[model samples]
Each structure stands twice: as C-alpha cells, then as structure tokens.
Target: MGARRRVREVRPTDGPLLEVEDLRTYFETRRGLVKAVDGVSFELIAGRTLAIVGESGSGKTVLSRSVMGLLPQRNVTREGRVRFAGLDLVGAPEHELRELWGDQIAMVFQDPVTSLNPVVRIGRQITESLRHHVGMSRSEARAAATALLRSVGIAEPEQRLRWYPHQFSGGMCQRIVIASAIACGPQLLLADEPTTGLDVTVAAQILDLLQRLQHERQMSMILVSHDLGLVAGRSDDIIVMYAGKVVEKAPTATLLSDTRMPYTEALLRSAPRLTDGSHRRLPTIPGAPPDPSDYPAGCRFASRCAYAQPRCAEEEPPLRPGAVPEHTYACWYPVGTPHGAEALELNRAGGAVG
Candidate 1:
C-alpha cells in the first residue's frame, strides 16, 4: 500500500474484449523447438466465460501464459496478435504490459502455494495491487483487501488477513489468490486450472465462488482446465485443443449435444458421469498425445482417433464451420457424419481407419 491517487473508471467497448489471432508460442529446448501453442485463435466477448478444455500438454496452459505475457523471455518465441481492449499485447512494450497486468487483466494461477509468497502476509499480498494499480492508501487498501476476502466467502476476513500462506488450507489459500486477482477490478480474469489439488466439494465451491464473482463484477474470464465436466456448465463457449491446436470449438450446449471431433467425444466419454456405477471402470483415451517437438504433418489426433480416415494422415484438416454456424471442428471424418460412421465400421472390421 502506498499514497492514494484517483483511479479512472473504464468504459465498455462494443467489440470483443480479447481477440487472439494465429497465436504461436514455441520454446527452444534441448530436444528441439517445442510448439506448446501453435496457430491458436479465438475471441472472448466482454462479461462472458470462455473455457479452454484439453488434456495436460495440450497447450492450454501455454496459451494462457502467452496471452498473459508470463512466458520466459529467453529460449522462447511468440508470434501473432493478442488484441485486448483494442491494444496488441504481442507487440506492446514491457512497461505497458506491467501497467495492464494487475489493473486491467489478472491471472489466477494453478497452484496457490507457488503463486503466493510463503513469508508475506495475505493482507499485504492482496493490497499490493490495490495500492499500486488502484491507487489506494494503506488503510483503504487493507480495508478493501478484507472486503475482497469476505466476498470470496472467507469468514473472519479481517483477522485472516494477517495470517501467512501456510496458516490457511489449500482451498482457503486459493480463495486468497482469487481475492488478490480481483482486487484491482480487472476487466478480464484468466483462471488456469483454479480448482487443481482441491477435493471435489472444495473444487465445486471455488468454481461457484468464481461464477458468482464474475457475475457480480461483470468481468470476462478464460478458464483453462482438462476436466470437461468441470467446465461444462460454467462456460458459455468451449474450445477443445489437441497437440498445440484447437480441434473443436462451439457453444457449450451445442458441444455437449453434438460433438464433431473424435477427440472431444473421447474426452466426454472418459469423464466420470453420475450415471456411471461404482462397479464400472472409467473410460479412457487409448494413446497419449503426440510429442510437441515432432508433431505429425497431418491431423495430430489421427493416430488415436477412432473415426480417423486415410485422408486424416495424408492431409491436415483446417478448422471449418460445422453444420451449425457457431460450431467448428478440424476433422475430415467428423462424428455423426456418414464418413465418420464408415470409418468407425472399418475400424471394427479389422481394417485401418486411416
């Protein structure tokens, strides 16, 4: 907390709040160049929740980090436009990014323990952004910090503010982190696997708190997670990513009702359903994701996809409009199509689908 200054209010814009176009984030590693995020593109409307759903190493985290400008400078290359509030973040100056980081945009990292300072008191951590970005005095910032904690459903927030990170449970610490992220009233919130490590009950509570806060603040959010079930109800739109690319994207209801990509179907099938009995074994994707350093020339999921066709290996499919206007997928033999049915039958008849 520091000297107080008047903070200006932000006006709403008509266009999408964030527009990522042909974004690619590659890392230089000993093995070779690892394309963690390649040619990804999407738009996030203001006050809406967009979910990026994929398995681990599917470039979900890397995509978030690229947008947040949190990737390491050395041994990394970022290409393409990350437009937010009409500003191109990819080409923006470092100082400009710093000014916007906690003020206009904030991120809730996966691990609260690593994200939070172990030695610093929770109050200081929360108030740091308030004072620096919001220009609140120490006392005012402290009061605001307490209110933030209280808003996140922390009881006795005033007393808890003085506690260290270790004093709180994992879920409580996550609440603290969320409080800090929303302290400055950011326009956008990027929550990367916010529910990781928490028990199912606690995870549900955290997601509910986030949804409530997003509604109250009218802030747009991008949730990055692997669990399709976790984001099914929470997100308005969902983007399914494979090895460094988006395989499917659609409105939540549309995606759930009619999934086109085989990878997306596999993910949905693998998820534990309430209808599943305790005696039933959970469904699983047969093979692992492709290595990023040496991805195949054609469709990345062709090897494991049950409805893959010979064309899937011979030629890469572009993300194209599906039967619906808002739904899109990158698969030559999409599910629910005649070609997909033939491919499935071929696989069943001991013939290679691709």
Candidate 2:
C-alpha cells in the first residue's frame, strides 16, 4: 500500500504579524473584470520591513488599500485571506476593524496634501483618532497630539498644531501624517511612498525619521515604492510585482546581488545608478506591462521578456524558493548574475528548466 500523504500543519497562530495568502482584488469595470491584484502573497514579520516594489498600475496601491479596508464596496471584490494578529481582515466586522485600525495599524499615503484635510486643524485630526480609538478626553488628546508633532521632528509643535493642512509645506504635511500614523504606536505601519512629493533632501530626512521610529518602536512596516534603490536600502525582504502578481521575492542583498526573475533583473538594470557614467541611452525594460483585463496565460511578462520561449506562453510557473528558503521567484527561465553565482550558473550553463 502507498504511504499516507503527509498532512501539512494548519498553524495560523504561528504566522507572522501579517500574512497575505493568495490575495486577489478584482474591479468590475464597464469593459470587463480587471484583476488588479491576482494571487499575490507575502508575509510581514514583526519588527521587520517588507518593500513591495513595482511600477504604477502593478496593483501595489490596490493591495495596500485592500488590506486597510479602504476600497469602495460598490464595485470592488476582495478574496483570500489577510491574517493580521490572528484576525481575518477580509471579512472582519466593521466596528471591530475600525477599533483595530488606528491603534493596531495605520497608513501614511503617497500624497500628504491630498490625504490631509485642508479645513481641519492638524491637532484636531491627530486628536480625533486618539479620542475615537483610545477614549482620551479632548484635553488629553490635544496634549498627545502636540507631543506627537514634536516626536516627528516638527518645530514649534504647539503653534503648528493650530494651523490648517494647507498652511504647511508638502514636507511638513507629510510629517504631520507620519506623526498621526504613529500616535497610537501601532504595531504595523503601512507607508505607501510616504515621501512621494517631497524634494530629494526632504525625502531622505523623512526616510531617516521613519527608520529611526521603526527601530525605536520595533514596528513592522510594509513600504510600497517604485524606487528600487529605496527598497534595496531599507527593506529586509523585497517583493517585485508585475501585472498584479509577484514575480520574485528575496532577501534584499540576494535580490540585489543576484536577481533571478527576468522582470526583477530588468527593473534593476533600468534603475539609474551613481556609478553609471554619461551615456545617451539608459537601460530600460522593452515593453509596457500587460493590461489587467487581458493578461497573458503563461507568464504576465512573456511579451516583454528577453528570454521568452514557446513554453513561456504555454505554462504558468508557481512561486517557489530559489536555491534556499528565503529567496523565491516565479519564472521558468530566470536570468543569471554577471559573475558566476549558483542561480546564475544553473540558468546559464545547463538546460535545467527544460
């Protein structure tokens, strides 16, 4: 008789702070169903950072919105599990989720000006969450708000708290947003390009502040950015998304030094490096990503992939570990390193995938 199949242990309790399992979000558009987030999955451990790197329309923003329960309910559909601190966010009750929202998790969006209310005082906005979530009295909330502003490196916190959103510069508004996000000391922080509109110098300062805060609070963060350099420097784990799916995920050093997936490699090659000398043409990915409504069957990147084979258009590959457990990629024909590496030698010297 054949041996009994091994039963995989179902241990949701042992999962990380947030575990996104086969999550998908679809939009019912007039043209057709747009699978904005198609079966993307990753885990964010406590006190660590996971950077979701992708180009625009790659479902990076949508995925973050779905987790935060911010999407419009009329035409949006979400599937699969988002287990956070043992609670299922996808189907959790609204009131309970609201209670958990600010204290357990909070978000700092890409654009601070758009996110902040122009008519409202910064102090009121910050204290509102404190009053609602922590049941603080108005005076106590105001005091806390002032402290938060100071904590995020805002000068003249007392005076700044009375000003409206529009009175502050873009960088100041972003700092206000960050201050409010950390008011309750949330265990999870979702920063979606939190430095998006700020100048380069200000952006660096903001990132430095965030990293310092994370270290002090030991908070888990999911940083969504289009900048590969940002991810390479800040994240412990890197997940590369293309056409609403994760093509590769690996430790930061491994992914940067020896990217396996073609899409990931292309993204790295296209990034501007300080080392690159003056050149007329910069390296770039050849084609645009597929339209969500009509993604190719086998590989979403096959159309743009430099090493596309007949099989690439015929079969989809499951995301699995590369060489070891922390490094994973989804491609039949991944790329190789410039110098000899294990993953590189495997792909270049042998016909392993065939």
Candidate 3:
C-alpha cells in the first residue's frame, strides 16, 4: 500500500486525470434513438474544474451521467472511451465500476430531495461510503461524518446527523448530500446542478463550498449547469453544448472574450447580467432546440443561428482547433470571423433575430 501511494505521488501533475474521447450516449426510445450525448470529447487536468453549460435539453446532465456510467442498462447505449486514472470506464465491468464509484469517483446529483433517503438518518447517508470504502469502524465513521457535515457548513453537526432528511431545509440537505459525496475523497467529482432549487445566497455559498473542497482535496471536478453566470467565474474551462454535441470549448476567459459559435454567442447574449437595468428586456434565442430523436444531417444549430449560411444547412462542421491554443469550435461561419459578421448583417436586414 505504501509503494502504491509512493507511485501516485511521483506521477506527473500535468497528466490528465480524466480523458473522454468521442463519447456518444444514445437511448433506444419507443419513438426512435434519442441521441442525448453525441460525439463529445474533452479532458481534465488534475485538480482543475471543467464546466458544461447549455440549455435544458442540450444534454449536459446526460453527459455527466454518461461519464460516471450511471445510466440504466435497459435501453441505454454508451460508446467511446472514458479514461479515469488511466482506466477505461465505458466497457468496464459492473464490479470494476462499483469499486470506482464513491471511492475514486463520486457525484452530487441535481436534486437533494430525491438523492437523500427520506427514511434514513443523515449520519448513515454520510458515513455509508466512509465505512464501506475506508473500512472505518462505527465510531470512527460517526466522527468522520460529523467532521464532514461541519466542513460543509452544517451547524450542530452531531445533532443534525440523527435527524431525518425530511427534517432539514433544502440548503441543509444539499450540504449533507455534498458531505456524502466527498466522504471518500474521490479523485473526480461530477456535480450536476449542485445549487439547483437553492436560493441565491445559499447557491453562492454552495458554489463556494464546492470550490473550497476541490482546492483542499486537489480533486478534478466536472460542474454541470444551465446558468452561464454561475460557470463564467468558477470554472477553469467551459464547454458549450447544443443538440447533444459540443459547439464551442475554450478556456473561460478566451471563450468569453473571443466568442465563437453563433449558438454559444446567443446563449451568452440571452443570459441576464447584473449590469442590465431592471426594466430592460431580456434577450432570448429565437426558435426551440432541435429534437434529438431525428437529428438534422447538417449542422444541428444552423436553423437558429444568425450567421448560418447555405453551407451550414448542407454540411455538418467538424470540431477543429481554433487559432488560439486549447480552443475548438464546430461552426461553418464562426462568430468573430468576417463571413460571420457579414452573415449577421444580412440576417438582421432581413428581419431575422441577430
């Protein structure tokens, strides 16, 4: 055990803790094939955070679930490589994935209410992983669970542990859920809408807690959210998804500054900013997201994009490296390019949303 720990310590920090390659997750629905996460790929360096942002139906949640191999087996078809600590997760056996879950990888689900067992006490929820994975005795697990709750900002940790999930507020329950997720000090944490259903102040606190925990544990995290404002400042990198594919990906600053992909630009423009006047109308992206059951042969976002050209509606654009390093976008007429500007001008003159 000491030798194994020594090897991990000697490993280079530059190595990717998680590498996803051409991941595709489809569901065989009664209507048709639902391509929830289609041909998406990304990598995360050790101890960094990657934020997946998109509209509700853009499949950010599904992508995160696919990464953890946490989908139902009945109609789900997941393809491609998910390498975590150099282990391929896509085709790994159930037992192998079970060992990885909660110990090496953990998830904080979208809703805390449904995630926590209503009948179970808070202490059991937090200590289950600790006792099972770390083999801690009952007393040791109890003490560790108390510390975990305290670290997550839950007051009266010892007293609260004995209470049922129904007894706590949403914020407190969410904090307890987080405590359970971090119990084993997982190397990677997938946080799907960690602050969902939380008030603004509590949401901010939750985000701060997550960031603080990530830093202290040096764990890689994949944060999924629909709000652009939430991710802009928090994540090291951002990936924008549309129609089950990554339309734009870049460092947080680069993507915000040198904005590319018309769809991504629309999302940014639509997000309400603090600087806007109270009465100012909120901008919205025109047209609905495309259906995933029967995907378009051309670029999926072309129908709603102001800069889309004939080429965009005829041929799909491949995700390629941009002029800037570590940036990739899938678009025929990328925003910030001359053709894109011209197309936007023409579309606006033609009474299209621009």
Candidate 4:
C-alpha cells in the first residue's frame, strides 16, 4: 500500500516443516463420536504450498486445525502425531502451543469478519503479535505494524491503524487480517479459504497476495479450499479429501494430468470450464457426502461414484501408490483402468450414472 516494502526473512528448512502421521481428530457428541479427521498423513516441506481440496464437510478445515493444535478440549480426542519443526504438538503444553501459534505458525481463517475484533483498532491488533512474540518496543512495534499493513496492500497504514474492522470493506478487512497474521513472520501459514465472502476480482487479489508473501517470507503454507479449480496453478502439491480421509494426493501437474481417483475425476468434471459458453448447463455430482458420525465401512465415495462396484460397498479402499512416483489414490477401480471403464459402462447401461 505504501512505497516501503518490508518482507520478513525466515530460515528455510531442508526437511518438512510440518509432518502429520495418521492424525485423527474426533469429537464426542450426543449422536455419536464424529470422526472429523480420520487417519490423515502428509509432509509439508518448508517454502512449499500444499493445497487441501475437497467439497464442504470434507474435513479440510478440521485437518488444518488439528495440525495447528487449535481444536478444543473436553469432548475432542486427537490421536496420532502432529510434528512441527521436529517437535510433536500432539501432547505439547498449552503455553508452548500458544507460543507457537502466533510466532512459528499462524492461520488466516475463512471469514475476515470473525478473524478480527470488531472493537479493537487495526493498528493495535497488528502490533500485539509483534510486541508479544518479537519482543519489539512500543514504538518499534508501531512502526513494524505500519510496514506490515503496507506489505499486505493496505494504504494509509498510519491512518488505517486507528480504524476498526467494520470500518473497512470485506477485502480490506481480510488484508488487515493477513497483516496481523504475518506480523511476526511465522514459518508456517495456514490459510483456510482465505477468499471467502469476496468478489471474484478481490478473491484473486487475495490469493496472489498470499503467494507473493509466501515466496518473500520463505514460509511453508497450507492452502485449504474446496474448489480444485481455484488452487490449480497456485499450489505445488494437492490433496483431495473425502469424508475425513485423503482419497488422492500428488503434485499439481501430475494429479491434473493423470488423475486416478474417481472422486477426483468427478470433481474435475463438475467444475465449470473456462472455454464453455455462457449459457451451458453446469454439471452436478449426484448423491450427497457421507455423514461423519455414521461413516460407511466401504469406500467413503462409493455411494456417489458412478464406477462403484458391488465390492466398493463392502470393502474400504486403502491409500496406495499410483503409476506416477508422487501420485497416490484410494480407489479399487481407478480412472482409465479397464475395471473402471467397464464399471462406468455398466452403470450407464443400468441408468445408474448420468
């Protein structure tokens, strides 16, 4: 927003910054134990962007919260390891987790309205992290907060500092949220649907700003979104989740080119194409996602998959390696395979698939 550019430098790690192994986050409810995140594992290398894509209620947000140790206590039970920077956060102390929250790891939540305090001044909120984590003096934190505001494309940083969240536009409020999140230069940034409640142009601007900031800060980012097309070119690696489990994972280019999971293919098919005419009818996925409290013994996507066989309804598919080195998918009859082809044909003949 201003002429000055202040990009905080973070030391890059040779290995993964965050390593999640068989992480399961379950909440005990009156209905039953809701398995929010079921045995998810992934490695996020420093300075790389990992996009977790899935439809709503797919546990993308829950997985991010679990990695950040942001889940609530009491009824929630978390199993498995969430290692960040070589330290396991699963059973870490509350004081230690609090320290890592705004310092080494920061999160940009979906709604900017909820991310910021309506009553607190913008400058104060941004400076709080710098003062608490960075041990900056009052004046130093104030100056740094101004610089942070500018870095996130907020103009008139000095004046805007006195303004409240409701005083700014939706996109501007999100920028302020980003400024606060990055004030301390966290090594890992978790942005969960950062573009929510914004127009298309503003959404693009927010995404581009995040990418630019990540590169400049040398920060490993987890970009959580429900749209595959949204994170297509923005992420280095992509993980497709369904019903609390990761169904497919691969490098961005490879996953799009050689997709093995039927669920992933269905998502791609349902997405609106850029070259399509304006009046074209949008394709929709049949059937709804499975309920978390009552998960199926079979494949999570079996009910909605057109290529699903009788075995799919009886057996759960394990996450296995694909033809490509980096690609992995959880599907018995994978896309482009003879079994999948025959299954799809059978479904079409019997009026099961559109």
Candidate 5:
C-alpha cells in the first residue's frame, strides 16, 4: 500500500476532536520528583488552533511532550488520559502509537537543528516518513518530498532536497521540518514553538504558513509557546499554564478581554504591545515560578500575585467556570471583580481577607 492506501480520517464529531483529562507527567530526579505537567485538561475541535502559553519553566514543553509520548520513559511517570480521535493514547501499545505518529499525528519540534538528522539529506528526511507510513515507492516518495518543500514555500525545492540540514539557514530548515511533519497529512499537529529561534519577520512567515496549511488541510493544531503576543490573534482557544498547572483557559477573544486569573492578567500586562510608546518600559511579572519539586501547598501563583490573600496561601482554588460560558480560571480573587479589589486592599492593609 502506498499513497493509495487510505488512512482513516477523523471527522468533526459532536464531541471534541481531542480531549485531555487531568494529565500529569512527573519525572524522578536526584533532587526530588518534578511535576512537569500537573493535572492539565483541555479540548480541541477539528480544524482549530489551541495555544498553550506560559513562561519558560511553566511546563508548556513538558505538557506537549507528554501528549505526544515523546518523553523518555526511564525515569518518568505519566498519569491520566489523552484521548485523540476516540483513541486513548496513554494506554495505546507502542506499535499502535508508532503507526499513528506520522500518518495520523505529527509534531514540528522547537528547534530544527536538533530535531533533524545532520548527516541525512533533506530529501531522505522528508521521504522517510512518506515511504514508511504512506508506503510510497522510492520515486513516488522523492516526488512527494519535492512537492512538500514547494508547499512550504521553499525555493529550488528539487535542488534543496539534496542538501543537508546544516547547509540551509535556520528559517529554511524550519520549513523543511514543517514539510516533513505534514507529509502524511496527519489529523493533529503539535507545533512546539516552531518559530523559536527565527527573527521577527521569519517567525511571522512561519506562523502564517502554518495557519494557511492548517486551514487548507483542516488539521487540528496545538501551538506551544512562551510569547503571548505570538498566539494572541492566531489561536481559537488559549490555555495559560503556571508552575505545571493550567491557571486559565478560554476562547482567545474572551480571555483577552475578560481575563480573570491574576497570573493571566499579569502575563497580558507583560507582553509588549504595538500601541505602547517606544520609550515605555514593559512590565515584568515579579518573582520566579515556584520550584516544581516542592510546589507551594496552596495556589501556585500566590507568591507572585499582588491580590493574593491568606486564603490563597491556605487553599488552592479549583478550576471553575467564569462569568462567560466556556471560560474557566483557578482564581479565588479574580481580576476586575469586587472581591479582587477588596483582597488587594486587605493585602496592603496587612489584614487577612480569608
């Protein structure tokens, strides 16, 4: 079976295209247990883009890696369920996962240089997945690789395929990686900071290309990033993570306008805005994220939040619905609310609100 072999298509259903339920990925280290991804849950619809945004140590990468089953299993323990297209990926056999990897699910890693094989030619790199997953013949795979390169807007597709990863610039290498990821037309795509090392212009081009390709193929995508501005307008839904847990989640527009979580509000304030004066200093979130190995007993973001109260330090708030439907946040003193204002005042007055 070659490209003629029809892979099962995952159509839009009454339920979500992907459902993650309380996923926890923990790693055992010499220091202690590191809770990389702690009790995170979200959903993605068919042909929609879900953006996971957080700071460097906020577990965004770990969450994505756990979902894709890319983490090393030696010292790792993964709990909870990751249901994709009605299949439970966490319990799926190795062979089953392998079969779905390129044909039904694929990932574009953060760095192309580290992800690609330095010794292998670009053509072989792209064709390998096609030949294996799609069962394409040698000539057919070669032609497909060329077309894939062209689809990603790479120049001299035929000639470029003969070159090695080191021969191309960083942006071009990233495009090649994207080509390889979509070679089999996977139903789901995980782009882990796909534009990480590129310049602003190149990053926009890459993001635009990803958007265009996702729309054309009707592919569901998870864009993992640390920059809020990058995903502000690009994604349909947004999940804000802090210290390995999701602090807030909502439709992009709703989250931007009606933010509730203090951590999320701080993140929005920290992002560089085009409307800001050139000389204006950008606001920065105070305090580093809590150590994952020994996280605080209560709310993870309490130490850094100005509105935090004694209750925040004593008990963690559960993720619950906000004023808007489908918007959820784990915050007792939600921003822009009377309770939040009173909490801040109490905090400044050296009084325990709770």
Candidate 6:
C-alpha cells in the first residue's frame, strides 16, 4: 500500500506510439525517498508487443504504475515524460486521462480477485466501461459484454453474467478481467504478469487469447512479467530491467540467440527447461537490488555484476547500442562474443558467475 505521488511530466515526443524518456518515480517513505524508477527510457511502436522482464522489486511494477498514472497524489514525485499518441502524460489532467484510460489504453492486473468488484455482477462490471467510455446504452453494453465473454472463452456467458467474483475459478476470473480490458477496444493494453498464479494450461490459454485479440484489433501491448518463456513466445521485443534501469533491450529472437547483457544471459539460463543436463546447476544472479534510498553511486548492479571492476564501482556506464544496432545494454563491458568467453572463464574460476 504505497501512496500515489503528484509530479510533473517532462520531455514530450512524437513518432513512436509510446515514448518514455528519463522517467523517474520516487516514493516518500519514513526512511527516505525511494527512487523506484530512475532514468528509464524506451519506445514502443503501434501494434507491437514489448515485454518488460525483471526480477521482483526491480521497479517493473512501479514503471507500469507511473505510466498508468496510478501513483498517489501525496508524497510521490515523478519526473520525465511519458508520451503516448503525441500527448505528454506526466502532468496530464485527470479528466483527460480518464477519457483515455479505457478507450485508448487499458490494464489487466495479475490478480483477478482484487481487480473485480465482489458486489457487482460480472456482467455489469465488464459492461460499465463501455457505457462510461463509449457512450453505449444499457442494453447495448450488456449485449457487447456477453459477446466479449464468449470471445474470451468463458462458458455460458449469459448465466455467468449474473454471478459474482466468488463463483468463478481463478482462470475464469482472469478471463473476465481480460474481457473487461478489451471491452473498450483500446489501442494499448498494459498487462502486469497476467498469467501469474494460474495453472500452466490456464496461463497458456490467457496468453493465446491476448495474441488473438491483439492481432484482430491491431493493438499494442506492454507485458510486464518475470517469465522468460512467456515473453520469448509472445513478445516481439524484450526489455530487461535491473535495479530500476534497463540493462538490455532487443528483438526477442535476437536476445534469446545472442544476449548482449550479463543480466539477460543470467535470466535466460535460470529459466526452467525439460531437457536433462546432469550436474548443471540452475544459474542465478547473486544478491538483491540495493535499497532505492541508498543505491550505490556507480552501477546499481555493480555489487552483483560478475564483470564489475574497480571502475564499475566508481563510475556508472552509459547505455550504448550493441553490435546488432537496435539492441542496447548499459554496461562498460557488454557480455557475449570475443570478450565474453574470457569473462565466463574468469567468473568460473572465481565462482561468482551465474
């Protein structure tokens, strides 16, 4: 339960469908200000899926919250620009954001229980957005809601419409959330770990539904999740974040085949596979993210990076474009290729590498 912050947006842009430049979000706590997202920047094209992958507490959720304008108005402070469709969102009026939220951009949460209202009928909850945002009448919204439920694969849509959140299974509830998110025919959808806490089959179904919807609607998506496999399968591009900053960003195929960042490589290695490889221990990046209030001066990940040198502790590296051109990593010594093997050998000798 964090308080939302009111801050000004800076740096508006054009060209890309969504552009985030030097975005910073800080929370006021008793200890100090928590700089959850500091100087993160990226772009998403229309109708393309950008998967944001990171470990827990890496500011993945915070960035999404900032984009959605969900942060509280109290002690939180936000700087930088979040421009979508040529409009700056940093200090956008609430009424303007409300008009866009359901019609232009929608969000699907990981947990269905908290997202849906218990007292309202599932039908009303899904249809309400259409009525408010699209100006659909009661009867029209209900019909549209029923069609949406069926489209999302919910069984017996008519009967289920009358039921409350308590009656549905986790998967069913998630489907309802998806239905609601799509009810307004939005152009951009922000799904925060949409498949978390569900059975593998159900999770796959949810992802499949999203892909189909995106294709049919020509919708763009910002998928926030830790599951590398899901991102690899569903996303066109991947953005790897660590300690409130992007370490690597590239096309998914490029990233999976040739990860240019040590952190991204570690994440790929840590993924569970069905293959049998004896004595090959699961790789893991050692140490947790530094407390935002007391982040290390140089690289936020320097304390855990295997390639860290004395300079790494003293100076932060700039995020530069990699060999592939579009792929970028923020490291003085980007991993992979000629220098990577020697680095891996050194790490093996010291037993500090993932």
Model 1: how far is 347 from its true place, Å? 1.8
Clashes of 4: 0
lDDT of each: 0.91, 0.84, 0.88, 0.90, 0.90, 0.86
Tell me the tens digit of each residue's lDDT in model 5 across 33-95.
Answer: 999999999989888999999999899999998998888969999999999888889977888
State the number of backbone clashes in model 2.
0
TM for candidate 4 is: 0.95
What's model 1's overall lDDT? 0.91
Clash count, candidate 6: 4
**TM value for model 1:** 0.96
- TM-scores, all models, native as reference: 0.96, 0.90, 0.95, 0.95, 0.95, 0.93
Tell me how many clashing residue pairs each candidate has: 0, 0, 0, 0, 0, 4
Which prediction has more favorable lDDT, 1 or 6? 1
For residues 231-281, what per-residue lDDT tens digits would candidate 2 score against the true structure? 688889999999999999998999988688988887888877778787736
- Tens-digit lDDT track of model 3 for 42-65: 999898999999999899999999
**Model 4 alpha-carbon drift over 4 Å, by segment:** 1-13
Once superposed on the true structure, which residue ranges of model 2 sit more than 4 Å away at CA? Answer: 1-14, 337-354
Error of 5 at 9 (Å): 6.5
lDDT order of candidates, top first: 1, 5, 4, 3, 6, 2
Ten contiguous residues minimizing lDDT sum, candidate 2: 1-10
Over 89-184, each residue of candidate 4 has an lDDT whose tens digit, in order, gives 999988888778888899999999878998899899998877777777788888998889899998888999999999999999899989899887
Candidate 1 has its poorest 10 consecutive residues by lDDT at 1-10
- Candidate 6 residues lying further than 4 Å off, grouped into runs, are 1-14, 346-354
Best by the TM-score measure? 1
| lDDT value, residue 127 of candidate 2 | 80
